[model samples]
Target: MQINQQIVLVTGGARGLGAAITTTLVHAGAKVVVNYFKSHALAEQLQQQFPDQIFIYQTDVTDKIEVEQMFNAAKQHFGQAITSIINNALVDFKFNGEDRPKLTNLQWSEIQTQLDGAVHACLNTLQAGLPDMQAQHFGRIVNIGTNLVQNPVVPYHDYTAAKAALLAFTRTTAHELGEYGITVNMLSGGLLQTTDASHATPQVVFDLIASSTPLKKVVSPAEFADTVLFFLSPWSRVVTGQNLIVDGGLVKG
Candidate 1:
């Protein structure tokens, strides 16, 4: 699981949390494929920054054809031997001035989109990447999850349910891929500061959560990126199918 000289693809990697993860992996000496749905400018900026080690692919994870094309393009650019994948793409949310979902008025189409964006994307990546990973006898798959699935303090019904399904998929994949030296795990976190996704949270809500945490602060994208790097590193080879919470002590086991 050494990241050096490895090929890793990160979905939704143009900006926000995904950007941090992509940068972290690139710094670790892994060749990175930065996937984005619409952030063309950011994707180009990242490619410019890591000219030799990074490449960009515009992909909508919810679209199976687009996802397939993305992987194909990455293989064509970096060869057909990718070693790792980080399933971190998600559809944009319309938070409606609150942290919780309006269950009674939530749109079914919106919910379906979130589920497809999260769960289906992971499934598609596995379907596309497994052949090569199994052949190479080494692979690392990390699915990003949310601490809300544990606490449900802010019931983002669609988001939490989708992530929960993703966690389940991670475990099942780990079990099936273990014999081949492929590891699959999840990293769940509470509100992460400085990400577009978290910008919707009211200042008061963030303050309250920070005060409640034993650490008294929200996690930075870099901190979360560090955990992801560890899971991708050889150190986590023995670990698989477990959801590791990184919520600054907000959700106790």
Candidate 2:
């Protein structure tokens, strides 16, 4: 299905990359359900911009019950099953490598939180949204990931480990769901130029990354979000179980 005919649920779709995805999809005429954990005001503001096209809802995607409720509400609001989902919600984390705890100091709880955000969040949404997708015989699932799995420049052990698990989940889900006309894939990116999560990163690091990239620039959230459109569009009907890195050729693999 094309974007206009799809109703998309974007977890954490109020700020940063989530906001960019919401804007991009809405502009393309997709009905969007913007899920936010705490960005009530920002979500409301985004809804105001495209009140008719966007449905702003507050829900913690990690909580199975809340996710179910959000899915039901989205279906009721749109009078149709959500045709796509962007698993973009992540637990609060900053990209300041210097401030991050050393491997010896990192706690299991830290790893658990990332797993909750990365893996568990995806699980809850898949379970809640799959029935509809099966009924319609069409669905698109795009899981947001990080290039740190391949190029762990900072070695965010907990975060990278969790994302690696998400990668596995993406492929496994694709294998299981493709028979039902659903496509599951991942879009991994490098340190975004600027986002709430990366604001703590020093400007020097950003400049260094930009200089190293073939594009000579750090990728913006909007630019990365634009690629999401292709995955959700009909052109990707046969594409699944792939991880497409969007880091401006910093890592060719």
Candidate 3:
């Protein structure tokens, strides 16, 4: 896919990592749909920042009906089938490892919530978009994953488990969709520097991560978002069902 020639939809695009991805896509000349569950004002602000490049829609990616409606509305608004989709919408979470539930004390509901937010959300969006992608016989899907699933240095039980589930689904879907010319992949990153979610992370933890990373610095959301662009662009057309870890060599996989 040519960045400037694709119609893109990014879920959870109102703030943080999603926001960075949306901005990068728009600037690269792709027409982007910004999907948000809340933060309408922030969405509008993004609209004003980059005029005529994006459409803001408030929808929950976890809901089948809403996901279908978003894709439909995107086609109507952009006058083209969405050629690329970024499943970046995350369920609300703060990256405070200290407060995260340990295995012995973890509640099923907590795990379920993460699953709903990550895995279920991806399923809803992928299913809703598949028909259009099949009709076009061309599409790109990128799911945001985490390095924790591989490195898991912090031991965020529920969160890492949910991301692992998403990775499994990503690969399975890619295999099924490969014949249709749609590629599915995951871009996993380590602790981002200062996103709303990571702001809650302790400075000591950040220092530890930076010191241990090959780059000796925490990955920024913008940097992670740029890696997402690679999957969406023509350079990666032959690649699918792979997890590209963009954590400065933190996790070898």
Candidate 4:
């Protein structure tokens, strides 16, 4: 799991699961670029805490130009070659409780927003980061997915659909890029206990999930971060295009 001297980029790295991933990468001896859309204050605070190891940049990953600029800025700071990326940023996870939209009433705008965060963000990062990895002949990409796509007991139609699409894209890209020594994989988890996104979930819903799981508990962001870091490390070189679910054995794939 040695990542010494590697430069890693994490989208939506300002807070929540993304923040956990960023912290893990930095602590693992990799130079980390934390990409945030609006959490400038938190990003700056994190950078201040790890001045020499962590860098922060603001970019809307849904936009091509912004994504390119983020990579360029990161390269300028961390050097031209980035070795890994963690796609963890997402739009609103507001469809949790009373606000959840039924499939019949789901608006195109709502669907598009989720798609922008899940699919488009990954596309932007892959398009921008692949060339550098290809040129360097080594790269690791880990896209964050959700357990809802498998269980769907709660039924977040838009979010689940978008993540399913992300998994498909990750597999296709992994196959296409394997010849170049680049590995693309996905990490999917369920009901992370203490993130801003998970806060929207109802207490009863979360409790049910926890009790039903073999582990009888929800996962922490740091726990999920561990899996992402594993993928980035040298140990996972032979693993690619697979969706690894870390949901307390709630959904066995």
Clashes of each: 0, 0, 0, 0
Residue 173, candidate 1: Cα error in Å is 1.2
Error of 2 at 44 (Å): 0.2
Best by lDDT: 2
lDDT of 4 by residue, 77-120 (tens): 97656678888998987637577898789988887899999999
- Order the numbered candidates by TM-score, best leading: 2, 3, 4, 1
lDDT for model 1, please.
0.86
Which structure among the candidates has the greatest TM-score? 2
- TM-score: the better of candidates 2 and 3: 2
With candidate 3 superimposed using the best TM-score fit, by how many Å does residue 109's alpha carbon deviate from the native?
0.8
Candidate 1 structure, TM-score to reference: 0.95
lDDT of 1 by residue, 1-253 (tens): 5798689989999888999999999889999999988899999999999999998998878777887887788888987567899999878864334645588888888778888988998988888888888898999999999988889887788888889889888899899999999999999988888688887777887788889999999889888898998888878889999999998999975
Question: Which portions of model 3 miss their true places by more than 4 Å?
Answer: none
Q: Which stretches of candidate 4 lie over 4 Å from their true place?
A: none
lDDT of each: 0.86, 0.95, 0.90, 0.88
Off by over 4 Å in 1: 94-100
Each candidate structure's TM-score, on Cα atoms with residue i matched to residue i, is 0.95, 0.99, 0.98, 0.97
lDDT tens digits, residues 69-108, model 2?
9999998998998999999997988899998878989999
**Candidate 1 least-lDDT 10 residues:** 92-101
